[model samples]
Target chain A: MDWQKLISFITVLVTLFLIVRSEIKKYKLRKTRPCGSDCNCAVLKEVSLKKLK
Target chain B: MNYFAIIGNPNCGKTTIFNELTGLRQKVGNYPGVTVEKKEGKILFKDGTEITLLDLPGTYSLTANSPDEKIVSDILLRKRIDIQRPEGIVCVVDASNLERNLYLVSQIIDQRFPLIIVLNMVDVAEDTGLIIDVGKLSKLLGVSVIKTVGIKRKGIDELKRAIQGKFQVSTAVRQWKLPEIVREEHEELTQLLIKHNSVKEDVAVYDAAALLSSPKQLKEFKDELKPEILDHVLLDHQRLESLGYDRHSIFVKSRIEWVRSICSEVVSIGEKKKSYTDIIDSIATHKFWGYIIFLTLMILMFQSIFTWATIPMNFISKGFDWIGYQLGALIPHGDLHDLIILGAVRGVGAVVTFLPQILLLFLFLGVLEDTGYMARAAFIMDRLMNKVGLHGKAFIPMLSSFACAIPGIMATRTIENPRDRLVTMMVAPLMSCSARLPVYSLLIAAFIPNLLVFGFWNLQGIVMISLYMLGLVMALLMAFIFKKTILKGKTPDFIMELPPYRLPSLKNILIQMWERSVLFLKKAGTIILGVSIILWFLATYPKIENGNPSEKLAHSFIGQAGQFIEPLMKPLGFDWKIDISILSSLLQREVFVSSISTIYNIQNADDKTVSLKSQMQKDLDTSTGLPRFTILTAICIMVYYVLAMQCMSTLTVVKRETNSWKWPFFQFAYMTGLAYLVTFIVYRVGLSFI
Candidate 1:
């Protein structure tokens, strides 16, 4: 492949990797703390988890 | 590092003081419930000592009525296993409303934490012709008192010095004496808790009193206490109530009486004069004029979003076009060049042009919030909210949803009733968050004309506000349905404090605008860019070497998927490309604009100068040989976006807030079903008129 094509291929690969990683992180965060990324009400999270269980 | 927590009643400027001390802009609005969760920042002292400062949500008392308020008592009582109790507490109170503000301080004194009282907003107090004897008040409270104007950074150094000094637990005696029988019951319960639950002696008293006052707290200790002990506590609660002593209000009443007595001793009235806040409030909160003024402000804000943002948007649009041209020339004619210009530049540029609109919206919201007008807006909205069977407190969360639904969902923690909170969460996403701004702006700017209405209002601006009002009306309608059918309950009384108005801090407003703008840019660079690249790939291959661009795209992977979905969307006047955009935007609403841009950029690869709006304007359906996006189509799409549950993040937050997958799934089904039904009706009705 040409140099430019090689760079484009690598860029696309990296973008895919980053998107997947972000999705996984968001999923795990949702499991533990459902208040989204903006809040840190861990007490509520615990109570919620206990209630869920 | 030593830890300190700043706690106070809502709107008393705990966040303002926290921001001033830590130099972090943690969103200090003049309305209550601005900080719905705990935010922590480190303050570096002069001697290289760093103290971790936590800004907790505001609460009225330690009795802990709502989930947000419960977080305060949980931390202070050391009930949560995750967070350690702070070494000292900074009890921030509004100097202008000391008598009411000190009720929480009295509760804190009973906890016996090393404390400092920040008499914030002293200027507001003085403007009302009240002088406070800080020294005498300090002696009476038996804690160090520091007077401060948090917004101006006045007395910050003194406050910091006091925080860094050796801390002492307040030696102030509990001034409010419990009645003889209530004291007996409280002491008895305290000993029982210490003996049975292994609770610490210091906190056991507070816990027992809380449990006796609010039997709901017994659920927290259910695992620790035996059934007999729980039954004993329940019996004491019943005995107090039977004796005609309101178990709930006795402590609150006594504390208020003590705070009033202290205020009488330490506060002196200088002159009886009407403040500016009063004069403005006469009309600002007047039942008739308030609605008129609010509607006028809404019109002006929506008008400015269009009028003020045009120049900057055009510049940004042209800048991206220039960059795309330059890059297209620099790279050889190949797939790499196509990817760079089509995938990255055009796609991201399509969304970035809306930055000016987003910034203007945040700026207006910041000014309204900073000047305390937002609270009045809530007050004005209360009667209507109650009529729809929602708590007046739900108004703040709904207003917050205009920025984004995530924080809006989180802000529902301040609603004490679960059913009311759930109903609010279900409808908050229908408020047309900033993510949908691109879709609305794109469609309206392309199809809606900018004629003068009644010799003043722009037709485009009116359409824009109408779209917003449509979302709001649908949200209220849904809330009403939910209240009357599934989530039926009596609307509780709405009691909100109307804060005195002050001049908005320009620096704070600018910081808010800057922060929101950066967040938008980040999303453009990350999610939008990623989706654009992927869409470009899907449309590019498998390649047809001898085919025209349209012929090539028609058989591409994205084309196949779009064509598959096109049949389902045909009734709504959407073609395959619009179907693809709709499906992609489920990840996030703004992705719809970028998806359309990417798709169009590939279709018109030969034409480099046409903007997305113009391309959309020229697009035609092959079967009918007519323009694909008529004004009716634009209106239908805009209506669909206003009601659609298209954001994954909002769904995830709903799942978390409601603590069930059932609610989020139900929300998705209902909102999407509503969107489809409404858009179908509008489209069919418009067709009949034509």
Candidate 2:
């Protein structure tokens, strides 16, 4: 492969690594939730931005 | 202990009330036969009483169309009740839109159940300077009315108390007001109810308009109704229409008038909260820029699916393949080793191939939906879609199809018009769904030289972009043709509310992503596993010893099946191996590439390390003296798969949503036929150029 092609491949590889890292972090976060009584703790609401305003 | 159900149109806040009353005590499970969920919980009142709250699907009216709407009618007549019927019903009405909301309320009243009204979003209406006299309105309707702002948990305790206040085993049955003449006729006829003082176990409106709106319900009512009751009902409906009030329409106009009158009495204008959605929507739904944004979003979606998930894909493929090899070494030599290495482990590895892209697809979709941007996306796309003699609702299905066609087609349930939905489903597969990306990425990398065009656009990116556009053009063209011919009908009038933008609920996004991944895995476990084993069996059985005993899979059942189809596809430059892979892809399109690898005995080849492009470059037909993959052949295959509806998951969704195998089966047949014809044309035309 030419230098440009090699560089392109490496750049893509880096991007791929970043994508996987982000995905695994998301998975780990989700897994810790563990389908318990606490699942409903999502607390569907705005973050009280009124106070900040 | 009696049960009650809360039902209304979407955004009615049935969920808010359920959360307020039940807290975390609800059980969320699927309705039987379909994946649509049912949420139910119980509340104990201070008066030594308890009530079960069934939060049915948020629906506009009781007419059964989609499985979601079917929940309303099903729960009312207690149809398909493995569980007990509720003694009472609470119909939710958005207070601001009371006039429109009460259309459903009146319909429920006709069912002759112990009904109550939970007027939600009262605060929003009040903030908009609208007032409502709840007591006066309650007296007019002769039903208990409870005011609630479910988001703030205000008046929830009162609503729960009211629910418990009226959970009687029975209520006095009152005939629906069908104007003067119908009231007189009802007096003359025999009592339709089980008792005068109790709610009718069942009630039917002799209104002609109701009959016109619902064929399924009318058909059933005709079989069961008393001759006189049925006769008078039809007459009353006609008489009302003569006065210019269609049974269904009049019921709405009057209720809306009543609600408006009550609001005039008690409500006053506050500072008008300007609808921010309008300002944002104006730009997003613009004719030109809206289309631009839609295309940009689609391109970004494709980029995420193909470019973002490469690492996880490589890891999974390499890891799984390594595991397969290790197991092969550990297992004793025999059919057992073949089954373990090539069938079970290899099959799993094959399915995992596309998991990264699927995950990314679900993640972005979840984010878009949870963040409330998808609603705006539909709104934006709707403007352009309407010009083509299609409804605005077509945008939702095509938008959702970007994640995967199956869910997208199923999502078409929200589109009220049947003809519109059918056309949407038929064309939805043409969207660059997550499923097609794997096949596209693999093929493009192998065929299209990786070089920049215009010193900017990568050749691979350009090809990917072209494939997406091709698919979209094909879908729209197909929809246009279908609308004009096969499923020809008037394009339904568009009416949809564009909800305000909200920060995406991260929790909801994560949960949705999890659910989709689990479902995909389950399907992969069954269909992909089965295909892999059958494939391994095809490529392995009846081995030729010099080439290895496992070389001649042609005598196997699957191999024979591929051979049978090979002659038809040979003109397209596809050999028997390609034929078999294409057949396997009836379950899923990605399986085609993996099957090709297996059939060619390149399953053990490290294509990732050597690059699939180089490997394909080296492969040749032993007798033909030409490479197996010519430029024309590559283009033909790409064009063919782009238009094909090869995913069984998509068909299953069509079947469930349509509640009939007819539409789904038709979709499969037409798509495959289109694929074949297009591939043939491409191959023939491109070969002439060469």
- Write down the C-alpha DockQ for each prediction: 0.38, 0.02
Looking at model 1, give its docking quality level.
Answer: acceptable
In candidate 1, what are the lDDT values of residues B310-332, reduced to their tens digit?
Answer: 99999999999999999988999
By summed lDDT, the worst window of 10 consecutive residues in model 1 chain B runs over B166-175
TM-scores of the models, in the order given: 0.96, 0.74
- Output the lDDT of residue B248, model 2: 53
**Residue A45 shift from truth in candidate 2, angstroms:** 39
RMSD of candidates 1 onward, in order: 2.3, 11.4
List model 2 lDDT by residue over B130-185, tens digit each. Answer: 77778877766777888987756788888877776653222323323445653454
